[model samples]
Target chain A: MSLMDKMLALDQRIIFALMFIALAFPILSPVILPMNIQQYSRDSFEFADSIPSGSVVLIEGGLGAATYPQGGPGLEVQIVHLLSKDIKLVFFSIGTETAAWTVTAIDNALAKLPSGVAAENGVNWVHMGYVPGGESGVAAFANDIRSVKTEDHFGTPIGQIPLMSDINKASDFAALFWWGGSEGSIPFGIRQIVTPFGVPMTGMCTTNEVPNYTPYINSGQMIGIIGGVRGSAEYEYLMGMPGLALGQAMATNFGGLLWALLVVLGNVLYFVARREGGAK
Target chain B: MQIPMILTAVIGLLMIIEFFFPMPASVTSLNVTLRSFVTIISATALILGTIVLTIFHTKKVGTRGSEWYYSIVYVVAFVVTAGLGVLNVRDTTFLWIYNNMTSPIGAALYSLTAFYITSAAYRVLRARNWNAAVLLVCALVVLLMLIPIGAILFPPVVPLGEWIRSFPSGAGFRGMIIGTSLGIMGLGVRVFMGRQKEHLGIREERRDSE
Candidate 1:
């Protein structure tokens, strides 16, 4: 076989191995790459920032650990930013297994909070656990928070929970920031919260799901976005707190480059082989 | 079949009315009751699925056919996980198993997509025709837009990628959404009218003849 043919026919196992090394190297050594913040993320940050302090913001956790590496950091950073601003958070989850992820994120954010600031569970913040009815459950929760979930994740009554007293329905919240991992919760949020209640919404989704969300932002349905690990990194940059999201974003960029090179090389070889009649 | 169809039709109509008009207290209560019934049935269905899976795998293991060891593993994992889950669901052991065992397996399985996608993209992303070429170029641009260095090197690539995603991709997604919504509405209508009574264990032909 010609060199181009040989390259074209290169074993994909080798490609996998190379990709493993390329992805692992960043995790081990970690690179701090420059971030060109996207306007969507910036707009999301500014919108979140604009929420009047002391007003409650309902944060939806629609992700789990399977997407934690790529999707969790954005939630963590957003939690930190929201908590830091003294915005009382009422976290509810519609995705299965997201209740745990929500608690983990809240813990991470609380650990990093400034001295004297506390994410007092059931007081400053509360997790409503995994609501059962998916889109219907979300609509129900929007219509009557008490009926959908009478108690927080800890079994404390919504009436007893200090933060819950302020939030009776979706319209009572200053804003809604939903973090979507795999299940795209944006449409549900739009239909239930944004449309019926007129509450402004924002989202942070996994890397692959980011492209699908831009239309919502363009249409003014979504006020801002934290788009995957890259969006998470931009958020960290804006927040001035560099952490896991930054590292993962750098790894993602390197991984993207490696894939791009492989694609370009593969195409080049195909063209060369065709021209040489060693081809096609 | 008749009763289920009547029930479905009545509830569906009520839901539609509830959405459009402010529901009376009795209608609201009925709506809430119906929604709760759905949630309960959904949970029960999950339990049924678990029982079905256990039986299937347990039978596979008991028969001891070739490759039955995998079934044995599955049965054991399900039992232990389900047992732990049942015995104080918030127990540290259950959480540990979920975090250390289930979560990692799921995450690892998901991560495998990266390798498959990379290999597949290399094999299939070619300039075979104008359509293929356009897809290839758009893919490359979006991939570049995800990278920080690419954005820094060619700033315009950012907006170019955004434009492609916002217009072409968005239009496609909207089309899919509209199509899916119409299909769902059609299915709902069919089901409520008893034309889709297979799930109720009644054959359509038998019902139609009756």
Candidate 2:
């Protein structure tokens, strides 16, 4: 075979091995790379920062096990940020799996809270875990909190929860933050809560889904969006609490670099083989 | 079937009307109750699905069908996990299963996508034509723009990628969303008017009667 033909026929196992190394190397020993925060992330951070103290805000924790690593750091940081500001948070997840992971994020955040933040459960925050039906469940929860959930995640009755006493519906909250992950339920929040009650909202979605939700931001239905692990790293950076996400983002950079080079190489080989009439 | 049709229409109309019109407290309360039913029904459906899955796998294992060993794995996993979950999902054993086993398995499966995509990009991202070349360039720019090292390697890729995403990709997604919204509205109207019976699991047979 010609050199071009052999190059064009390079085995994909080699590519996979390289990619595995590319993804794993930084995770083993971390490196920091220069990353300018994207506009969408900045908008999301600013929206969270803009919330007034003591104002109640609703959060939809929609990150499942597969998505937790990407959006979890950002969720933890956002919890810390809001709790430190003394903003009351009401969290609910639409999926059973996501609800549990949300609890983990909350616990991690709670551990990192500033001294004397008054983040008492059922008072400063309440997790109405695992609201079942997707959009319909969001609509129901938005319409009447007690209609869907009578108790918090820890099995505390909602009626006895001091934070939930005055909050019966969506309008009671000042803002909405949807850490939607890969659920694609940010639109559910926009439709059921923001559109109906005129509550401003921000969202977080997986990296690829970012483009799909950007129009909502432009149309003003959503204030902003945090897109994937890079977005999470940006959130950590903005909060001045650099964590796992920043290092993970660097790993992503390494993977992307290797992937891009392979693509270019494959294309070059294809063109050369085609010119020599030795390509498929 | 007719009763379900009527109920679907009534509840769907109530929600639509409630959205557009200011309803009295009594009407709002009724609508709230109806919407909450969706959650209960969805949960019931989940349980039903689980039962159906268990039955399918049990029969496979009983009959020694293709990949019956896999069925054995599923049966064991399901029984153990579900038993623990039923006893108390918050129990430490159940939580350990979920956190260690289920969570890691899911994450590993998801990470496999990166490997496949890397190989696929190398093989399938070739530009053999004019339109393909444009797409390839755009994909390259956007990929570079998204990763942290892109700006360090090439500065202009940032703005180029932003323009591509904010305009062409954004407009494409916007168009898709609008189309999907309209399609959903059409489907809702069909369902509400009893023209769509498939959602109710009542298929309309068009075969000739012999």
Candidate 3:
């Protein structure tokens, strides 16, 4: 077979092995690639920063175990950012699994908080826990919190929590943050809270799902979006605290370069073979 | 069937009325109650699904059906997990199982997609025709645009990739959103009018025959 033919028919196992090396090498010894912050990430950061101190913001922690590493650092940083500025937070999750991971993110964030930041659980922030029933659950929780959730994620009653006293509905909060993370449920927040209650929102989703949501950002429904691990890294960078996501994002860059090279090479080989009349 | 259809209509209409109108407190209270029922019903449906799945696996195990060992695995996993969960979801062991075993497994499974996607891109992303070439180029541009090394390798890809994502891609997504919204509205009306009985689990004769 010709070189083009052989290249075009290169074993997929070889490609997989190459990809493994590309992804794993950076994780072992991370490379610091010069990166630009995406406007989406910037807008999301600015939106979070613009929320007034002491105003409560509602967050939908919709990231699960699979997505935690990608969106978790960003969520933690956002939590720290808000708590440091004295911006109280109320977190809830739609997925059963994600609710647990959300706790991990919150705990991590609280652990990393700068000295003397008020990290009170009930008084400053509260997690209403896994609200079931998808968009219906969101709408119900947005309209009347007490109806759906009687207690916080812990065993404490919602009524006993000081944060729940004045905050009853979506309209009560200053802004909404939906860390959707591949759930593709950003629309739930926008439809149930943003449009009906006029609560300005921002969100995060896996990198592949970014385009699925950019329209909402453009239309002003969502202020911005943090897309994937790179987004988490960007948020960490913008916050001037680099951590987990930055290293993962470097690995992602290496993987991307290898994938891009293979694609270009495959196409070049295809074109050459076609010109030589060696391909059908 | 008729009762469910009526309930769906009434509840849906009341929610809509509550959204767009200045409704009475009683109406608001009633809507709140109805919406809360959604959570309960959906939660119940989840339990029902689990019960059905358990039955299927149990039957498979009993009959020694195809790959029945997998059924045994499922049954064992479910029983152990559910037993611990019922005992105490907040138990240290339960949380440890989830955090250590479940969480890492979930992450590893998801990361496998990275390997699959890389191989797929190399093998399948060929410039076979005009449309294929356009898609390939667009995909490459976006891939380059997202990675940090792309800008260092070729600076112009940054702007070109940004434009493609912002304009063409954004416009296409908006169009899809609008189309889907209209389609959903159409389906909603059909469901409201009881012409769509699928949600109620009423299958058509032709569909069943096929």
Question: Compared with the true structure, what per-residue lDDT tens digits does model 3 show for residues A212-279?
Answer: 88788888999979999999999999999999998888787878888888888877777777798876
Candidate lDDT (C-alpha), each: 0.82, 0.90, 0.90
Candidate 2, residues B89-134: lDDT per residue as tens digits? 7889999988999999998988788888888888889998998998
DockQ of 1: 0.57
For residue A104, give model 3's deviation from the true position in Å. 0.1
- Candidate 3: Cα lDDT at B41: 89
Error of 2 at A171 (Å): 0.4
| Candidate 1 local lDDT, A1-280, one digit each (tens) | 6666677777999989988988898889876767778888899999988887788999988777777776677778788788878888989888658878888888877888888876788878889887777787787778777666777887787788877776778999989998877778878898889988899999888878877776677789898788778888888889888888888888776678889888888888888777878656
Q: For model 3, what is the error of residue A259's alpha carbon versus the real structure, in angstroms, after optimal superposition?
A: 0.6
Categorize the docking of model 1: medium
Per-prediction TM-score, chain B alone: 0.89, 0.91, 0.91
| Colliding residue pairs in candidate 2 | none
Looking at model 2 chain B, which ten-residue stretch has the lowest summed lDDT? Answer: B201-210
lDDT score, candidate 1: 0.82
In candidate 3, which residue pairs clash? none
For candidate 3, the lDDT comes to 0.90
DockQ of 2: 0.79
Q: Name the top DockQ candidate.
A: 2
Across residues B1-210, which tens digit of lDDT does each residue of candidate 3 receive?
899999888887888877788999999999899888999989889989998999999999999999999999889878888789889877878788788988898889988877888778877788898999889989989988888888888898889987888788999999999999999899988988998888876676557888
